[model samples]
Target chain A: MKVDIVVDARYKSCPGPLLALAEAVMKASPGQIIMLLATDPGAPRDIREWALNVGHKVLNIEKADETYQIYLEVSS
Target chain B: MSKISIIVASEKLDKLLPAATLATTAAVMGWESEMFFTFWGLLALKRDYEPKEVSSDYKVYEDYLRRAVSSGAMPSWLEILEQGKKTGRLKVYACSATMSFLGVKTEDLVEYVDGVVGAASFLSKAKDSDINLFIS
Candidate 1:
């Protein structure tokens, strides 16, 4: 429920949303929660796949209107 | 770690976009990503060179793609590639043969190119990759 960082990548397509989140994660400490606001339809799946590969955790994903609010936990 | 090797053979916007997208995505995903720019693709590595047009076959959709980038919906191909390089998991290589044929010197290439290599050398590096793709 508490968010440590907010990454807004709305309307950016494909890798844009994912890249923004990846960059933010790199700068965050372990266990910090990052909320990514993206409008790209593929962002949720892309983030999940990226998290799976890089050992991050997706806490939750919620859609409001056309935007997706994806919560992620940075991993050590 | 997973590894992806890509052979890029065109300089057109459409070709470069997909190639860069995949390579950068792989790198962002923490995979080892390498791209070999051959023939026309090597032209794209020239310093300050910007791909201005999609392949002629896709002319009808050229404006559509351009609009996406200009409107900020999609990042430019080079921007994507640069992000991938920053991850330290991506390697960009220029083709030795193409350089010779096109008279392109090492100095003519952008600073990120890791090396100029022949087919055999690139193949050796790519042989162990988990995914391999040739994009034109």
Candidate 2:
């Protein structure tokens, strides 16, 4: 699904993308979807675990040219 | 959000970096994290602390390690901790006994240090954490 916020964490390392996503989640309203684009090899697992722990819904994590796009819907 | 509490008890850079890195991850994940710096670990939190002891424990790779860190390829542990603090989910504390022994006052610590906490208080915080770690 299309998202409201797109976090560009393309070249950043571990925790950077996650941090940016966390900040975006705090500012985003419930029912909005957000996407995080990250290149770190650890980002996918981090995103999955973080979303699990924080009660967010993970839509999918797709790969595009060595970068990953993690999508999540804000849980109300 | 989950909770992570770390007890840092080593002076070595290798040992300290992981603790800070994990704390950063926990913070970024929107978890509440508390770090207790005790004994040797307290040195890293000092206002004037410098990482001059690079590779001290890894003598064989001392030159390589120093170059990697000094060249800005790797950020210092303290820098990682500071980034974690920006999430407002990370809190750092100095061990009270260490503070008294080292003659370090509250003002002598970096701004990220929430305060000085004794073992009992620290244990209480750790007790409620979903993930408790001891890094040395």
Candidate 3:
């Protein structure tokens, strides 16, 4: 299965949405591809590193203007 | 596993505790977590502040933050979040603009932060995240 998750991190308050997404992905079945969208500059490297540390693959990273597109493949 | 971004913008201990708790909880559940401390939230990562007593309703928050720290107790707000970075797959970033506004040198921040960056950089990086949060 494939899912596209958009995390609007542009606000200066609230971290619940991001945490929810991570929990959802962790509970998802294997072989799922999740595309995450974030606006925080730290999202790319931070997410990439987290995926790597927890046995997920960061498939692609693309940037357009002020947005980021991160693709992940669940391996576990 | 996927990407999660938690953005903190408030400097108040009360307001910041929720975001920290959520991030640490996600990490404990085996999910990869990243907390981006921006604006006033970056102040909580400063090395000099001590943990203050919160209201009774906030005891859970205090407890959670305490547990997330290294000494099995909250050393301070700064220490609590720092421990989250160490014990879990958590990465913390200080907002570049905020740092400059607050006259926060890189050396002034606690050791848990991964780097200092502007909003543009943070937005570009977080664009592909699975989850994004903004905590006040």
TM-scores for candidates 1 onward, in order:
0.98, 0.80, 0.52
Residue B31 lDDT in model 1?
93
TM-score (C-alpha, index-matched) for candidate 1: 0.98
Docking class of 3: incorrect
RMSD, model 2, all Cα superposed?
3.1
Residue B48 in candidate 2, Cα distance off native in Å:
4.5
Model 3 per-residue lDDT tens digits across residues A1-76 = 3565444433212233234346557566677777776665766776766676567888887888877777777786
Each candidate's root-mean-square deviation in Å?
0.7, 3.1, 13.9
TM-score, structure 3 vs. true: 0.52
The parts of candidate 3 lying over 4 Å away from their true place are A1-76, B51-80
Worst 10 residues of 1 chain B by lDDT: B49-58
Query: What is the alpha-carbon lDDT of model 3 when measured against the actual structure?
Result: 0.66
Query: lDDT tens digits, residues B1-136, model 1?
Result: 8999999999999999999999999999989999999999999999999888999889999999999999988999989999999999999999999999999999999999999999999999999999999998
lDDT against true structure, model 2 = 0.82
lDDT of 2 by residue, B1-136 (tens): 5799999888677777678889988887778999999998998888778755643557776666567567654556766777789888899989999989989888888887887889999998889898988987
Error of 3 at B9 (Å): 0.7
**B54 Cα displacement, candidate 3 (Å):** 7.0
